[model samples]
Target: MALPLVLFDVNGTLSDMGRMTQHVEEIGAPPQLAGLWFATVLRDGFALTAAGENPAFRAVAEGALRVVLAGQVLNRDVDDAVAHILTAMQQLPVHPDVADGIRGLTAAGFELAALTNGAATTASGLLERAGVRDAFAAVLSVEDGPGWKPAAGAYTHALAALGRGADDVVLVAAHPWDIDGASRAGLRTAWLNRDASPYPSAMVPPDHEVAQLGDLLSALRT
Candidate 1:
Protein backbone atom coordinates (compact mmCIF):
# COMPACT_ATOMS: atom_id res chain seq x y z
CA MET A 1 0.00 0.00 0.00
CA ALA A 2 1.09 3.54 -0.63
CA LEU A 3 2.09 5.46 2.47
CA PRO A 4 -0.03 8.31 3.69
CA LEU A 5 0.93 11.83 2.73
CA VAL A 6 3.11 13.39 5.44
CA LEU A 7 1.98 16.80 6.68
CA PHE A 8 4.67 18.66 8.62
CA ASP A 9 4.42 21.48 11.10
CA VAL A 10 7.00 24.14 10.28
CA ASN A 11 7.81 26.11 13.43
CA GLY A 12 9.60 24.21 16.18
CA THR A 13 9.00 20.91 14.38
CA LEU A 14 11.33 21.64 11.47
CA SER A 15 12.93 25.05 12.05
CA ASP A 16 15.43 25.57 14.88
CA MET A 17 13.87 28.42 16.84
CA GLY A 18 16.52 28.04 19.58
CA ARG A 19 18.63 30.41 17.49
CA MET A 20 16.14 33.16 18.27
CA THR A 21 17.57 33.54 21.76
CA GLN A 22 20.77 34.91 20.28
CA HIS A 23 18.87 37.35 18.11
CA VAL A 24 16.79 38.46 21.09
CA GLU A 25 19.93 39.01 23.17
CA GLU A 26 21.44 41.12 20.39
CA ILE A 27 18.85 43.79 21.18
CA GLY A 28 19.60 43.76 24.92
CA ALA A 29 16.56 41.66 25.85
CA PRO A 30 16.85 38.59 28.06
CA PRO A 31 17.60 35.44 26.10
CA GLN A 32 14.68 33.73 27.83
CA LEU A 33 12.33 36.32 26.30
CA ALA A 34 12.71 34.56 22.97
CA GLY A 35 10.64 31.63 24.21
CA LEU A 36 8.19 33.79 26.08
CA TRP A 37 7.54 35.87 22.98
CA PHE A 38 6.68 32.85 20.88
CA ALA A 39 4.42 31.46 23.58
CA THR A 40 2.71 34.81 23.82
CA VAL A 41 2.04 34.86 20.10
CA LEU A 42 0.47 31.43 20.25
CA ARG A 43 -1.58 32.34 23.28
CA ASP A 44 -2.91 35.46 21.64
CA GLY A 45 -3.53 33.70 18.33
CA PHE A 46 -5.42 30.90 20.01
CA ALA A 47 -7.46 33.37 21.96
CA LEU A 48 -8.41 35.21 18.81
CA THR A 49 -9.40 32.00 17.07
CA ALA A 50 -11.54 30.93 20.00
CA ALA A 51 -13.33 34.23 19.74
CA GLY A 52 -14.09 33.53 16.07
CA GLU A 53 -11.33 35.61 14.56
CA ASN A 54 -8.60 34.47 12.23
CA PRO A 55 -5.53 36.34 13.37
CA ALA A 56 -2.57 37.09 11.17
CA PHE A 57 0.59 35.42 12.45
CA ARG A 58 2.90 38.35 11.79
CA ALA A 59 0.60 40.82 13.44
CA VAL A 60 0.25 38.65 16.51
CA ALA A 61 3.97 37.98 16.64
CA GLU A 62 4.90 41.63 16.29
CA GLY A 63 2.39 42.72 18.88
CA ALA A 64 3.59 40.06 21.25
CA LEU A 65 7.21 41.08 20.70
CA ARG A 66 6.42 44.69 21.49
CA VAL A 67 4.60 43.72 24.67
CA VAL A 68 7.35 41.36 25.76
CA LEU A 69 10.07 43.91 25.03
CA ALA A 70 8.28 46.86 26.62
CA GLY A 71 9.96 46.57 30.01
CA GLN A 72 13.38 45.67 28.63
CA VAL A 73 16.02 48.39 28.24
CA LEU A 74 17.05 47.81 24.66
CA ASN A 75 20.31 49.13 23.22
CA ARG A 76 18.59 49.80 19.91
CA ASP A 77 15.27 51.34 18.90
CA VAL A 78 12.24 49.15 19.77
CA ASP A 79 10.97 49.14 16.20
CA ASP A 80 14.40 48.08 15.02
CA ALA A 81 14.42 45.30 17.58
CA VAL A 82 11.04 44.07 16.30
CA ALA A 83 12.24 44.22 12.73
CA HIS A 84 15.39 42.33 13.68
CA ILE A 85 13.51 39.49 15.38
CA LEU A 86 10.97 39.23 12.56
CA THR A 87 13.71 39.07 9.97
CA ALA A 88 15.48 36.41 11.98
CA MET A 89 12.24 34.40 11.92
CA GLN A 90 12.17 34.44 8.15
CA GLN A 91 15.75 33.18 7.99
CA LEU A 92 15.55 30.37 10.54
CA PRO A 93 17.43 27.21 9.58
CA VAL A 94 15.81 23.84 9.57
CA HIS A 95 16.73 21.40 12.27
CA PRO A 96 19.72 19.10 11.61
CA ASP A 97 17.57 16.08 10.72
CA VAL A 98 15.05 17.83 8.47
CA ALA A 99 16.80 17.68 5.10
CA ASP A 100 17.90 14.08 5.43
CA GLY A 101 14.58 12.97 6.84
CA ILE A 102 12.52 14.80 4.24
CA ARG A 103 14.63 13.31 1.48
CA GLY A 104 14.37 9.83 2.95
CA LEU A 105 10.61 10.05 3.25
CA THR A 106 10.32 11.36 -0.30
CA ALA A 107 12.59 8.65 -1.70
CA ALA A 108 10.47 6.10 0.10
CA GLY A 109 7.41 7.35 -1.83
CA PHE A 110 5.78 9.35 0.90
CA GLU A 111 4.55 12.72 -0.37
CA LEU A 112 5.34 15.59 1.97
CA ALA A 113 3.82 19.02 2.66
CA ALA A 114 4.03 21.72 5.30
CA LEU A 115 1.34 23.50 7.30
CA THR A 116 2.17 26.40 9.60
CA ASN A 117 0.46 28.96 11.77
CA GLY A 118 3.00 31.44 10.43
CA ALA A 119 3.40 32.53 6.83
CA ALA A 120 3.82 30.01 4.02
CA THR A 121 6.66 32.12 2.64
CA THR A 122 8.59 31.66 5.87
CA ALA A 123 8.10 27.89 5.82
CA SER A 124 9.06 27.68 2.16
CA GLY A 125 12.06 29.94 2.70
CA LEU A 126 13.35 27.81 5.55
CA LEU A 127 13.08 24.63 3.46
CA GLU A 128 14.48 26.38 0.41
CA ARG A 129 17.51 27.49 2.40
CA ALA A 130 17.92 23.94 3.64
CA GLY A 131 17.95 22.67 0.02
CA VAL A 132 14.71 20.72 0.43
CA ARG A 133 11.95 23.01 -0.80
CA ASP A 134 11.21 20.91 -3.86
CA ALA A 135 10.40 17.92 -1.71
CA PHE A 136 7.22 19.50 -0.38
CA ALA A 137 4.15 19.37 -2.58
CA ALA A 138 2.62 22.37 -0.81
CA VAL A 139 3.51 24.85 1.90
CA LEU A 140 0.41 26.19 3.65
CA SER A 141 -0.48 28.55 6.49
CA VAL A 142 -3.56 29.36 8.57
CA GLU A 143 -4.03 32.29 6.21
CA ASP A 144 -5.20 29.70 3.73
CA GLY A 145 -7.35 28.05 6.31
CA PRO A 146 -10.34 29.06 8.43
CA GLY A 147 -8.46 29.57 11.67
CA TRP A 148 -5.31 28.80 13.60
CA LYS A 149 -4.48 25.18 14.40
CA PRO A 150 -6.06 23.33 17.33
CA ALA A 151 -9.12 24.58 15.49
CA ALA A 152 -10.50 21.78 13.30
CA GLY A 153 -10.89 24.16 10.38
CA ALA A 154 -7.14 24.49 9.84
CA TYR A 155 -6.61 20.74 9.40
CA THR A 156 -9.79 20.52 7.40
CA HIS A 157 -8.50 23.19 5.08
CA ALA A 158 -5.27 21.25 4.61
CA LEU A 159 -7.22 18.07 3.87
CA ALA A 160 -9.32 19.85 1.29
CA ALA A 161 -6.25 21.29 -0.42
CA LEU A 162 -4.59 17.88 -0.52
CA GLY A 163 -7.84 16.41 -1.94
CA ARG A 164 -7.52 13.62 0.57
CA GLY A 165 -9.49 12.44 3.54
CA ALA A 166 -8.11 12.66 7.05
CA ASP A 167 -7.18 8.97 6.96
CA ASP A 168 -4.77 9.49 4.07
CA VAL A 169 -2.68 12.14 5.79
CA VAL A 170 -0.50 12.16 8.88
CA LEU A 171 0.47 15.25 10.86
CA VAL A 172 3.97 15.37 12.32
CA ALA A 173 4.55 18.06 14.91
CA ALA A 174 6.56 18.79 18.04
CA HIS A 175 3.65 20.38 19.84
CA PRO A 176 1.18 18.21 21.70
CA TRP A 177 -1.57 20.74 21.05
CA ASP A 178 -0.99 20.41 17.32
CA ILE A 179 -0.92 16.61 17.44
CA ASP A 180 -4.06 16.56 19.50
CA GLY A 181 -5.75 18.95 17.13
CA ALA A 182 -4.89 16.87 14.07
CA SER A 183 -6.03 13.72 15.83
CA ARG A 184 -9.29 15.36 16.76
CA ALA A 185 -9.67 16.43 13.17
CA GLY A 186 -9.46 12.73 12.16
CA LEU A 187 -5.89 12.62 10.83
CA ARG A 188 -3.14 10.39 12.17
CA THR A 189 -0.36 12.12 14.09
CA ALA A 190 3.28 11.65 15.01
CA TRP A 191 4.83 13.54 17.88
CA LEU A 192 8.41 14.56 17.11
CA ASN A 193 9.78 14.42 20.62
CA ARG A 194 13.21 15.88 19.99
CA ASP A 195 13.68 16.78 23.63
CA ALA A 196 12.70 13.37 25.06
CA SER A 197 9.91 15.03 26.98
CA PRO A 198 6.98 13.03 28.28
CA TYR A 199 3.76 13.29 26.31
CA PRO A 200 1.17 15.41 28.04
CA SER A 201 -1.58 13.34 29.61
CA ALA A 202 -4.34 15.82 28.91
CA MET A 203 -4.09 15.74 25.15
CA VAL A 204 -4.92 12.98 22.71
CA PRO A 205 -1.71 10.95 22.38
CA PRO A 206 -0.10 10.76 18.96
CA ASP A 207 -0.22 7.66 16.79
CA HIS A 208 3.58 7.58 16.67
CA GLU A 209 6.43 9.25 18.51
CA VAL A 210 9.99 9.68 17.26
CA ALA A 211 13.08 11.24 18.73
CA GLN A 212 13.84 12.98 15.46
CA LEU A 213 12.43 13.56 11.98
CA GLY A 214 14.46 10.81 10.30
CA ASP A 215 13.03 8.23 12.65
CA LEU A 216 9.63 8.61 10.99
CA LEU A 217 10.93 6.64 7.99
CA SER A 218 11.30 3.59 10.23
CA ALA A 219 8.46 4.32 12.62
CA LEU A 220 5.83 4.54 9.90
CA ARG A 221 7.11 1.50 8.04
CA THR A 222 6.37 -0.64 11.06
Candidate 2:
Protein backbone atom coordinates (compact mmCIF):
# COMPACT_ATOMS: atom_id res chain seq x y z
CA MET A 1 0.00 0.00 0.00
CA ALA A 2 1.12 3.55 -0.64
CA LEU A 3 2.09 5.54 2.41
CA PRO A 4 -0.73 7.62 3.83
CA LEU A 5 -0.28 11.32 4.33
CA VAL A 6 -0.48 12.05 8.05
CA LEU A 7 -2.68 15.00 8.84
CA PHE A 8 -2.20 16.49 12.28
CA ASP A 9 -4.66 18.61 14.27
CA VAL A 10 -2.89 21.61 15.73
CA ASN A 11 -4.29 23.03 19.00
CA GLY A 12 -3.96 20.56 21.84
CA THR A 13 -2.73 17.74 19.68
CA LEU A 14 0.48 19.44 18.68
CA SER A 15 0.78 22.48 20.91
CA ASP A 16 1.15 22.14 24.66
CA MET A 17 -1.86 24.11 25.82
CA GLY A 18 -1.18 23.25 29.46
CA ARG A 19 1.66 25.75 29.33
CA MET A 20 -0.95 28.47 29.12
CA THR A 21 -2.04 27.83 32.69
CA GLN A 22 0.82 29.95 33.92
CA HIS A 23 -0.13 32.71 31.52
CA VAL A 24 -3.69 32.64 32.80
CA GLU A 25 -2.43 32.79 36.39
CA GLU A 26 -0.16 35.67 35.45
CA ILE A 27 -3.28 37.60 34.50
CA GLY A 28 -4.64 37.11 38.05
CA ALA A 29 -7.24 34.54 37.05
CA PRO A 30 -7.34 31.12 38.63
CA PRO A 31 -5.08 28.63 36.83
CA GLN A 32 -8.02 26.32 36.25
CA LEU A 33 -9.55 29.00 34.07
CA ALA A 34 -6.94 28.15 31.43
CA GLY A 35 -8.64 24.89 30.60
CA LEU A 36 -12.10 26.42 30.88
CA TRP A 37 -11.09 29.29 28.63
CA PHE A 38 -9.88 26.91 25.89
CA ALA A 39 -12.98 24.76 26.23
CA THR A 40 -15.07 27.87 25.69
CA VAL A 41 -13.18 28.67 22.51
CA LEU A 42 -13.73 25.18 21.10
CA ARG A 43 -17.38 25.23 22.21
CA ASP A 44 -18.06 28.52 20.48
CA GLY A 45 -16.16 27.48 17.37
CA PHE A 46 -18.03 24.22 17.12
CA ALA A 47 -21.33 25.98 17.80
CA LEU A 48 -20.67 28.51 15.09
CA THR A 49 -19.68 25.83 12.63
CA ALA A 50 -22.82 23.87 13.41
CA ALA A 51 -24.83 27.03 12.79
CA GLY A 52 -23.26 27.26 9.31
CA GLU A 53 -20.92 30.09 10.14
CA ASN A 54 -17.14 29.92 9.76
CA PRO A 55 -15.75 31.55 12.85
CA ALA A 56 -12.14 32.69 13.19
CA PHE A 57 -10.43 30.79 15.97
CA ARG A 58 -8.67 33.76 17.46
CA ALA A 59 -11.83 35.84 17.40
CA VAL A 60 -13.82 33.13 19.08
CA ALA A 61 -10.97 32.61 21.56
CA GLU A 62 -10.76 36.30 22.42
CA GLY A 63 -14.50 36.48 22.93
CA ALA A 64 -14.42 33.35 25.05
CA LEU A 65 -11.62 34.85 27.16
CA ARG A 66 -13.69 37.97 27.76
CA VAL A 67 -16.60 35.84 28.86
CA VAL A 68 -14.38 33.69 31.06
CA LEU A 69 -12.62 36.63 32.60
CA ALA A 70 -15.77 38.56 33.35
CA GLY A 71 -16.37 39.09 37.10
CA GLN A 72 -13.03 37.47 37.88
CA VAL A 73 -10.36 39.25 39.86
CA LEU A 74 -7.61 40.25 37.50
CA ASN A 75 -4.16 41.80 37.71
CA ARG A 76 -4.90 43.54 34.47
CA ASP A 77 -7.99 45.07 32.91
CA VAL A 78 -10.17 42.85 30.71
CA ASP A 79 -8.70 44.06 27.44
CA ASP A 80 -5.16 43.57 28.62
CA ALA A 81 -6.00 40.19 30.08
CA VAL A 82 -7.47 39.09 26.76
CA ALA A 83 -4.47 40.39 24.88
CA HIS A 84 -2.12 38.55 27.19
CA ILE A 85 -3.86 35.25 26.63
CA LEU A 86 -4.03 35.72 22.86
CA THR A 87 -0.31 36.40 22.66
CA ALA A 88 0.39 33.38 24.81
CA MET A 89 -1.69 31.25 22.45
CA GLN A 90 0.63 32.12 19.59
CA GLN A 91 3.66 31.24 21.67
CA LEU A 92 2.54 27.78 22.88
CA PRO A 93 5.23 25.11 22.64
CA VAL A 94 4.85 21.68 21.12
CA HIS A 95 4.55 18.49 23.15
CA PRO A 96 7.81 16.69 23.98
CA ASP A 97 7.02 13.87 21.57
CA VAL A 98 6.34 16.06 18.55
CA ALA A 99 9.78 16.75 17.13
CA ASP A 100 11.02 13.19 17.37
CA GLY A 101 7.72 11.74 16.17
CA ILE A 102 7.54 13.99 13.17
CA ARG A 103 11.15 13.24 12.27
CA GLY A 104 10.53 9.54 12.61
CA LEU A 105 7.55 9.72 10.29
CA THR A 106 9.47 11.81 7.82
CA ALA A 107 12.43 9.48 7.89
CA ALA A 108 10.11 6.59 7.23
CA GLY A 109 8.94 8.28 4.00
CA PHE A 110 5.58 9.53 5.19
CA GLU A 111 4.18 12.85 4.10
CA LEU A 112 2.87 15.08 6.92
CA ALA A 113 0.64 18.10 7.07
CA ALA A 114 -1.12 20.20 9.67
CA LEU A 115 -4.82 21.03 9.71
CA THR A 116 -5.92 23.64 12.18
CA ASN A 117 -9.05 25.56 13.10
CA GLY A 118 -6.65 28.29 14.11
CA ALA A 119 -4.49 30.36 11.77
CA ALA A 120 -1.98 28.70 9.46
CA THR A 121 0.60 31.15 10.74
CA THR A 122 0.07 30.00 14.31
CA ALA A 123 0.44 26.35 13.35
CA SER A 124 3.45 27.14 11.23
CA GLY A 125 4.98 29.09 14.07
CA LEU A 126 4.50 26.21 16.46
CA LEU A 127 6.13 23.73 14.11
CA GLU A 128 8.92 26.14 13.31
CA ARG A 129 9.71 26.67 16.95
CA ALA A 130 9.83 22.93 17.35
CA GLY A 131 12.39 22.89 14.52
CA VAL A 132 10.10 20.88 12.31
CA ARG A 133 8.30 23.41 10.13
CA ASP A 134 9.99 22.23 6.96
CA ALA A 135 8.91 18.72 7.82
CA PHE A 136 5.34 19.51 6.80
CA ALA A 137 4.07 19.38 3.23
CA ALA A 138 1.40 21.94 4.15
CA VAL A 139 -0.06 23.85 7.07
CA LEU A 140 -3.76 24.54 6.57
CA SER A 141 -6.50 26.29 8.51
CA VAL A 142 -10.29 25.93 8.47
CA GLU A 143 -10.45 29.61 7.65
CA ASP A 144 -9.69 28.53 4.10
CA GLY A 145 -12.56 26.11 4.19
CA PRO A 146 -16.33 26.39 4.59
CA GLY A 147 -16.27 25.96 8.38
CA TRP A 148 -14.39 24.71 11.40
CA LYS A 149 -13.44 21.03 11.64
CA PRO A 150 -15.90 18.30 12.63
CA ALA A 151 -17.66 19.95 9.71
CA ALA A 152 -16.87 17.87 6.61
CA GLY A 153 -15.86 20.87 4.57
CA ALA A 154 -12.81 21.52 6.68
CA TYR A 155 -11.34 18.09 6.09
CA THR A 156 -12.30 18.27 2.43
CA HIS A 157 -10.30 21.46 2.07
CA ALA A 158 -7.23 19.78 3.55
CA LEU A 159 -7.57 16.70 1.35
CA ALA A 160 -7.91 18.91 -1.66
CA ALA A 161 -4.80 20.88 -0.70
CA LEU A 162 -2.77 17.69 -0.58
CA GLY A 163 -4.34 16.48 -3.84
CA ARG A 164 -5.27 13.27 -2.10
CA GLY A 165 -8.46 11.43 -1.34
CA ALA A 166 -9.84 10.72 2.12
CA ASP A 167 -8.49 7.19 2.15
CA ASP A 168 -5.03 8.43 1.40
CA VAL A 169 -4.81 10.42 4.62
CA VAL A 170 -4.86 9.82 8.36
CA LEU A 171 -6.12 12.49 10.70
CA VAL A 172 -4.41 12.52 14.08
CA ALA A 173 -6.00 14.55 16.84
CA ALA A 174 -6.34 14.66 20.61
CA HIS A 175 -9.95 15.78 20.43
CA PRO A 176 -12.51 13.01 20.03
CA TRP A 177 -14.78 15.25 17.97
CA ASP A 178 -12.02 15.66 15.43
CA ILE A 179 -11.31 11.95 15.24
CA ASP A 180 -15.02 11.22 14.85
CA GLY A 181 -15.42 13.82 12.15
CA ALA A 182 -12.44 12.61 10.17
CA SER A 183 -13.61 9.03 10.43
CA ARG A 184 -17.02 10.04 9.19
CA ALA A 185 -15.43 11.96 6.37
CA GLY A 186 -13.81 8.74 5.14
CA LEU A 187 -10.29 9.41 6.32
CA ARG A 188 -8.39 7.08 8.62
CA THR A 189 -8.26 8.40 12.20
CA ALA A 190 -5.80 8.20 15.08
CA TRP A 191 -6.61 9.54 18.50
CA LEU A 192 -3.62 10.80 20.48
CA ASN A 193 -4.62 10.04 24.04
CA ARG A 194 -1.80 12.00 25.64
CA ASP A 195 -3.32 12.01 29.11
CA ALA A 196 -4.55 8.40 28.98
CA SER A 197 -8.18 9.49 29.08
CA PRO A 198 -10.84 7.00 28.16
CA TYR A 199 -12.29 7.39 24.69
CA PRO A 200 -15.84 8.67 24.77
CA SER A 201 -18.35 5.97 23.89
CA ALA A 202 -20.57 8.41 22.02
CA MET A 203 -18.19 9.35 19.21
CA VAL A 204 -17.12 7.34 16.21
CA PRO A 205 -14.01 5.60 17.45
CA PRO A 206 -10.62 6.14 15.86
CA ASP A 207 -8.98 3.47 13.75
CA HIS A 208 -5.88 3.70 15.99
CA GLU A 209 -5.18 5.07 19.43
CA VAL A 210 -1.81 5.71 21.06
CA ALA A 211 -0.59 7.32 24.24
CA GLN A 212 1.88 9.62 22.58
CA LEU A 213 2.76 11.05 19.17
CA GLY A 214 5.94 8.99 19.00
CA ASP A 215 3.85 5.84 19.17
CA LEU A 216 1.88 6.67 16.04
CA LEU A 217 4.32 5.31 13.44
CA SER A 218 4.49 2.03 15.32
CA ALA A 219 0.71 1.87 15.63
CA LEU A 220 0.29 2.42 11.92
CA ARG A 221 2.93 -0.13 11.07
CA THR A 222 1.08 -2.73 13.09
lDDT of 1 by residue, 56-150 (tens): 89999999999999979999999999999999999989999999999999999999999999999888889999999999999999898899998
Clashing pairs in 1: none
Q: Candidate 1: lDDT of 153? A: 98
Which 10 successive residues of model 2 have the least lDDT summed? 76-85
Q: Please provide TM-scores, in order, for all candidate models, with all chains considered together.
A: 0.98, 0.99
The segments of candidate 2 whose C-alpha lies over 4 angstroms from its true place after superposition are none
Error of 1 at 33 (Å): 0.4
lDDT of 2 by residue, 1-222 (tens): 899999999999999999999999999999999999889999999999999999888889998999999899999788998888999999999999999999999999999999999999999999999999999999999999999999999999889989999999999999999999999999999999999898889999999999998999999898
Model 1: runs farther than 4 Å from truth? none
